[model samples]
Target: MTATAIVLLVATALSSLVPVIVRRRLRSTLVVDAVTTAVMVGFAATAAALAADAAPARGVGVVVVACAAMIAAVGGGGYVVRLVLWAGGADTRERARDSATGDGEHVPDAESESGTEAEAGPLRGGRVIGYLERAAVAATLLAGWPEGLAVILAVKSLARYPELRAPHAGEQFIMGTFASVLWATAMAGVGFLITH
Candidate 1:
C-alpha cells in the first residue's frame, strides 16, 4: 500500500478505538466532547492531506476506504456523544428502567392511559435507526446531494413526532439527533474532502 493509504488506515483504526476508550473510561463531558471533536478534525485534515497528493489510479480505492472509514467514524462518534451525555448526568439507564416500568415522569407509556399494563418499552429499535440514519446522511452528503439532508431530517422528525410529545422526548431527540447528524456530517465532509 502507498504511504498515504497506510497513514489513512492507521488513522481510521485509531479513530475507531476512541469511542470505545471514552465509553469505558467514562470521561467528563468536556473531555469527551473535546476528544470527539479532535477525532473528527483529525479525520478531515487527514483526508485533505491525502487528497492533495492522491493519484488518479488511487482515487477509487481511496474513496471507498474513506467512505468506510466515515461510516465507522459516525457510529463511534455517536457513541462518544452518548458517553458525554451520560457523563453529564443524563441518567439514560434509569430513564430506560423507568420507561420500562411506565413510571417515568418524562416518558409516558402509551398504554397507561387505557388502563392496560405497559406492554411496550421505551421506543425500540433506536440504535439500528441511528446507524441507518447516520449512514444515509453520510452517503447523501458524500454523493454531493446536500439537499437530501433536509429530507432525511424531515422524515426522521415525522416518524418520531409522536414520541416527541413526551416530556423529555424532545430534549433527547434534539440532543441525539444533533450529535448523530453532526457526526455524520463531519464524517461525510471528510470523505468529500478525500474524494474531491
Candidate 2:
C-alpha cells in the first residue's frame, strides 16, 4: 500500500478503538470525542489529498475497507455514549422510575410504578437497530444518496415514537442517534474523498 493509504488505514483502525477505550473508562468522553473528531477530520483531509494525486486501482479496496471501518467506528462510538450516560447517572431504569413516580426512587416493579407492564421489559433490539441505522447511513452517503438519510430518520423516529414518550428513552435516543450519525457521516465523507 502507498504511504497515504497506509496512514489512512491506520488512522481508521485507531479511530475505531477510541470508543472502546472510553467505554472502558481509560479516557473521558470529552477527550475521546475530541480525539475521535480530529482523527476523522484528518482522515478526510488525507483522503482528499490522495484523491487529488489520482487514485490508484487499489483505491477501490481502500474505500471498501474504510467504509466498513467507519461503520464499526460509528457503532462503537454509540456504545461509548451509552456507557458515558450510564456512568453519569443517566440509567434508563432509574430515569423511568423517577419519571413514573415523580421522584428519583427505585421501584421494585414496572407495573407497580408505571401501571403498565409493557414498560418493564428491556429496550429490546436497540443495539441491533443502532447498528443497522448507522450502516444504512454510511451506505447511503457513500452511494451518493444523501436523500435516503431522510427516509432512514423518518422510519426510525416513527418506529420509536411511542417509546420516546419517556424522558430517559428520549434522551438516550437523541444522544445515541446524534453520535452514531455524526461518526457515520464523517467516515462516509472520508470514503467519498478517497474514492471520488
Candidate 3:
C-alpha cells in the first residue's frame, strides 16, 4: 500500500506536467502543432498494441491491474484539476479584458472563446473520446500490455481539444465526470478479466 501510494504520487505529478512541458517545448505554432499531433497519434497506436499483448501475462496480472487503477485515478484527478484551472483562468482573463476595455460590465464567456484562441487543455473532444482513450489505456496496461502507457498518452495528447465558448461550468463538469467514470469502468472491466 505504501509503495503504491508513493508510486501514484509520483505518477500524478509527472502526468500533470505533460501538457505544460509539451506546450513550453513545442510552442503553439501551426507547424509544431502538426508535428505534435502526428507524434501523439503514433504513440496511441503503439501503446494500444503493447497493452493488448501484455494481458494474461503469468504472475504479473495483479501488478498490471494495480497499475491500471493508479492510472485511472490519476487521469480522473487530472480531469478535475483541468476543469478548475480552466474556470479560474477564464475568470482572470475576463477580468483583465474588462479592465482594459473599461467596459464596467463583465464580458460573457462566449466573448473570449469567439474572439481569441482557447486555452490549452489535456481534456478534449466532448469527453466521450477522452473517456474511451483513458479507459482503454488503463485496461490495456492492466492486461499486461507493454508500452500501453506511451500510446495512451499519445492518444490523449492528440485527441485533446478545448471548448472555448462553453455556456456554463456545469456543462464542463458533466463532461469531465462522464469521461472519468467511463475510464474507471473500463479499468474495472479489465481488472475483472485479469483476476479471473
Candidate number of the best TM-score: 1
lDDT by residue (tens digit), candidate 3, 77-150: 34443343345453333344456568645444432348544433322333355546555655665566747766
Model 1 alpha-carbon drift over 4 Å, by segment: 1-6, 17-44, 49-58, 87-89, 94-123
Looking at model 3, the pairs that clash are 43-151, 51-145, 54-144, 54-145, 55-143, 124-161
lDDT of 2 by residue, 59-171 (tens): 55765656545654554455455544555555544355566777654455444456554432234456567778888888888778999999999999899888787757776
Specify the poorest-scoring 10-residue window by lDDT in model 2. Answer: 21-30
Candidate 2 to native Cα RMSD, angstroms: 7.6
Please give, for residues 105-168, the per-residue lDDT of candidate 1 as tens digits: 3343343356544422234456566777888888788777999999999999999988777656
Number of the top-ranking candidate, with lDDT as the measure: 2
Off by over 4 Å in 2: 1-3, 14-75, 83-89, 92-124
> How many backbone overlaps does candidate 2 show?
0
- Judged by whole-model lDDT over C-alpha atoms, candidate 1 comes out at 0.61
lDDT per model vs. reference:
0.61, 0.62, 0.44
Error of 1 at 126 (Å): 2.4
